[model samples]
Target chain A: MAIDWGFALRIAGFGLLLVFSILALLIVITRVVTRFASKKGPEEKEKKEERE
Target chain B: MIDYQTGFTGLTYGHIILICVGLIFIYLAITKKWEPYELLPIGVGLILANMPYTGLLLTPEQAGGVPGVAGLLGIFLEFGLYKYTVLPLLIFLGLGAMTDFGPLLASPKGFVLGAAAQMGIFVAFFGALALGFWGIADFGIKEAACIGIIGGADGPTTIFLTAKLAPELMGITAVAAYSYMAMVAIIQPPIVRALISEKERKIYMKPQLRAVSQREKIIFPIAVMLIVILLVPRAAPLVGMFMFGNLLRESGVVDRLSDTAQGALINTITIVLMLCIGASMSAELVMRPETLMVLGLGLVAFAAGTAGGVLLGKLVSRLSKEPFNPILGAAGVSAVPMAARVAQHIGQKANPRNFLLMHAMGPNVAGVIGSAVIAGVFLGILG
Candidate 1:
């Protein structure tokens, strides 16, 4: 059977674009969650500062 | 009574060559300590598999209608690898238990570097297709996709993808991936140096990372699972198990379970998985010219991955207001701590006071997730 170059190229393009988009979304979500969790109490802020 | 022949009756040049290859793997494992856990067992398996008429591994005819009389290694390959796909996912569980997402949580930019590094996968994919198109090799889309994942520098991911797309090439791909991972210390430096300038390597970031709270730590895995699975439901098997293992570690309530998952469970699974993978490498299977080509293409993929990560690091460093050492970018190839250590070593060589271990780890861990996500993408499209 002959190899389908076009389909393979499409797989590459779509797979990469999907990976980047999902990871980017993850970064955004993580930042938001961490920010909210930190804002809940000054004790948390103090602990974070101490650790740093 | 005199019909008995020696076990070496059917041995040939192919068997000798494969035996020698197995010996080389053993030598590397013992002397150089190159992924000894994997290579040693794999070496032993290869030796056994190549021994003529040992019946250690069942032939297809033997397995077809045999009842309670199957080759030991054949059983492992069929059940552990092809039939159930259990070992790789279990390994991910251990990896998750062993991993601490603290660094990644502290510096989220590592996620971007991690994603960027997966460019190696696509680059190799394209290369394989081009080779196939030109009749240089017979790499179809499935074969090309499996070969490309070796660049991910994640062993379980490589095995998982290969199992799904090209089980025929499993032994070689696993060997290539682990071998490159073992040599990350050597293969990465020159490429990183070529891509990153001396000043960029010496660029110092503060050592302090924000401490993640227990609550956030507990929530991280759940959040990751929800988002990732929602985005690509096909990732559930690998990513879901990984997150579950992390949750066990971070939950603090399941210490015993977490310890076993990371320690005994993982080690046991590693032995079985590596041995079975090795046993699959019979002379007739791996002695082809295509095997050599796959090995060469695997190297190309790895180098491309490192280059991709380093190049992205340079780009991110240029754009961001904060000083970013481009060398940390090389850590995005997901060889776990080794790749990160290479980044740290390169950084320290440039400047004595510079410490990039923790910084590099951000991307190092992120690379793990990135590779899995890419694996999911491939499975989504191809599987």
Candidate 2:
């Protein structure tokens, strides 16, 4: 009985950790990409400045 | 010799009760648009299963599920659903085709929320174990694992895993998974609202500036599937079907097959599976006090899972300089866009400018992959 419960918790924790870490990594990548895409140019910012 | 003038009308109360229940399912599908995906087929199958002397459930000759003979659908329940494990796989393939992994690929960090959301799965599993100790369903480690995935709120994954690990509980587990996913629109809004303030909801997301090429879309699924599937073969049945459907979608050549998989195949399978499920819910089998226990534990599991995801969101927000609205954490239950939308809706209500949907999708889709991985891991650990 003790073994069954411990096994359940371990399996559960492993499942949660595996999925959550991957999701967190996906977010970090998206943030990095967002920063990269936004750095396209001062000129792009200037063009928008003119419009505003 | 007896004065029995029976036609299609059911012969006994057991027969009549189940037959009518089946017909009602059909009516709900045709008229109510109530989970048309599975309800229609289930309704039809249920009607067939319930009819007296139709013998939808096969039993030992002496056992009395349908008296003397087995019906056509009974064979399907036995061979097609139980024996071959064909229907759940097909459903997953269709779900994969319908799903767009673009949002997930674009923002991979969303995977964390997906993972965090699965805390609910483990919580649910532990809950099941406790319930088992307290004398719940004939639930063992594997059975508890199957039941716990319901917190993932992913029907295909739940069914796929459970149908393999604990076929006896498929009826309850599948229905619970779908029911929760469907109600996610209703259940999650309050939870999202409770967690985040108005300012957070109104945050606007800048438009996705980069163009996603067709090649990238096609290659991503194949590569990811290869990486994940090769690593965890147990995950292949669910992941493989999902990826194959996605490949079919992105291939741009198999529109016909994709359409059929997404529409016809899914519809047909859903109908059959739902009926097979409802048929499993016979008065003798389902109408027990333990069902309430199952439902109560399900709610607890969902609530705990939501809390876990949101708490992780809070942690991420605290750790990052850029504010990460923890409301998105509640969206991690893999109810797909529904949970994500709730997070978005709640965020907007708090801060009318905050756009949490795209952010939430990261976790939402992550939740999908997360659920699959968790299922794979569970299957692996148990195996």
Candidate 3:
């Protein structure tokens, strides 16, 4: 059977693009969630320090 | 007339060569301490499979005849690898249980670097196409796709994709992927150093990583599963099991299940999986010019991945305010702690005060996700 060069290349292009986009979305979600977590961390730290 | 049948009766020089190859793998695993858990079993399986007329593993001819007539190892291969795709996916579950995504959660940019390292996969894909198109090798798109994943440096992902796309090439591709993964320390440093200068390697950032909240840790796997699976439903089986394993570990309520998944379950699956992978490497299947080409392409893919990660690290470092050691980018090849450790070793050598392990780990783990996503894409397209 003959190889489909066009299909292979298309998969390569589309695959890389999808991987980056999905990972980019992940990075965004992680940053947003961590932002809230970091905000809460400071307040908790302050309360602990005041109690001490 | 007395008829004599012995293993030696059908043995050929090719079988002997494969036996020697198996011994070499065993030697490397034991003395060299190279992925001993996998290579050791695989080496033994290779020896067992290559012994002529042993009936330990049925030839394809025998397998095609009667279902009950197949050997024990043949049954394992048929059911475990081809039938259910159980072993590789189970290995992924164990990997998920063992992995800690805290570093990745702390530094999300590592995800980008992780994605960048997959450049090797695409590059090798095109390279394989060119080879096949030019009659250099007889690789169809499916076979090419299988060969390309060796660049991911993720063993289970490689096996999973190869099994789905090109079952014939599974043994050689698995060997190539794991071999490079085992030799990350040796293969990666030169490429990393060549890509990034001494100044970049010496660049040290603060070691303190913000603590990831338990809630965030718990949510991370779920969130990842939803996002990745939604984007590439083909990746659901591997990603779902991986996330399930992580949830068990992070849930704080299932320590027993988590422990079993990470320890006993993983160890048992690794032995069986590696043996099956090795046993599949019979001389008739493995002793071909195409196998050598696949091995060569695998090395190229690995080198390209390391280079891609390091190069992107340089780009990200220049853009970010914090001091970023580009050496950590080499960890994005997804060989787990080995790639990260190599980054740390190289960084420390450049500057004793520069510790890049945790930083490298962010991208290192991200590479795992990245490879899985890429594999999913290939399966979606080809499978």
Candidate 4:
């Protein structure tokens, strides 16, 4: 089969973009979830203060 | 006169060469301790399969239509590798069970480093295609993709992708992946030192990461599974199973399942997978110009990946508020503890007070998810 240089370039370019984008989104999600989980209850807040 | 075919009669120059190659693998494993768990079995399997008249590689039909007995290695290759990609995925599940997401949660920018490390995969993908363009090798897009994933510095991801897109290239690619992973100590340091100055390497990171709460730990796998799978549905088989295994570990409720997946389950699958990988390398398949080309391209992929991660690490270090050692970026190539250890070793060499191992692991584990995501992308586009 003949090689399609244009198509191959797209796979390289877009494949990388997609990988970064997805992982970046995971980073955002992780930050949000951790923030929310850290603020859930007074008991947890008291425990955090004690540890600090 | 008795009519019986002796093993010596069937042996030829090609078989002899393969046997020697197997012996070299054994020698490396035993003497050099180079990936002994894998290389040793691979060596034994390669030797066993090449021994002519053993019927180790023959199916029932090939064995004169025998009903009771069949080739053990042949069954493994067909079922474990070719027919179903169960073994590699199960390996991922075990890896997930063994992984801890605390470091990644403590420092999220490592995600960017992890993604950057994957640049080698794409670079090698194009390199393989360029060989075809130059009329140097007969590699298709699928073959190029398989060769490229070796940059991820992951064996199971390489195997899973190759078995899906190009089964013909599995043995060579797996060997290339493992060999480079073993050589991380040699390959990474030079690239890392060249990219980051001694001043940058001496930068210190605090040893204590933010204590991750149990609730956050439980939520990580589920959230990753949902988001990643929704974005790249094709990644479900690998990402799904991997996260499921992590959930088993973190949930703290399924100690039995978690222990089994991490211990007995992964060990059993690894033996079968490694042996099958070794057995697949016959004389004719490996003794080709393309095989050599694939090996060369795999090295290019690995080097390019290390370069990509370190370059990004330099940028992140310059921009971040907290001190960051660029050497930590080398761990983003996803060789797991080995890559992380290399980063820690180099950092300490520059300054005795530096402790980068815990910080380096953030990108190290992130690289695992990064590579698996890219594998899903390739399957979605090319498969």
lDDT of 2 by residue, B1-383 (tens): 78764545645565566668667766866786656666666556655555565555774332444545655566667765777778778888888888876666665556676777777777778777777787755567887788788888888788778878887777777767766766676777676667755555444455352444566567767766876776667888888998899899988999999998888888787766777787766555555565666666667667777877887777777676656788878887888778888887777777676777777776787788778888888888775
Writing each residue's lDDT as its tens digit, candidate 1 over B180-265 gives 99999989999998888888888887777778877778888999999898888887888998999999999999999999999999
Error of 3 at B276 (Å): 0.5
Off by over 4 Å in 3: A37-39, A42-52, B59-68
Best by lDDT: 4
**Each predicted complex: what DockQ?**
0.54, 0.30, 0.62, 0.60
Pairs with backbone N, CA or C atoms under 3 Å apart (clashes), candidate 3: none
Error of 2 at B215 (Å): 2.8
Candidate 2 regions exceeding 4 Å error are A1-3, A21-52, B2-33, B43-48, B59-70, B207-210, B321-323
User: Which of the predicted structures, 2 or 4, would earn the higher DockQ when compared with the native?
Assistant: 4
For every model shown, the clashing-pair count is 0, 28, 0, 0
Better of 1 and 3 by DockQ: 3
CA shift at B59, candidate 3, in angstroms?
8.0
Q: Model 3, range B137-167, lDDT digits (tens) per residue? A: 8887888888889999999999999988899
Q: Over the full model, what C-alpha lDDT does candidate 1 score relative to the true structure?
A: 0.88
Q: After superposition, how far is residue B178 of candidate 2 from its true place, in Å?
A: 1.0
Residue pairs with clashing backbones, model 4: none
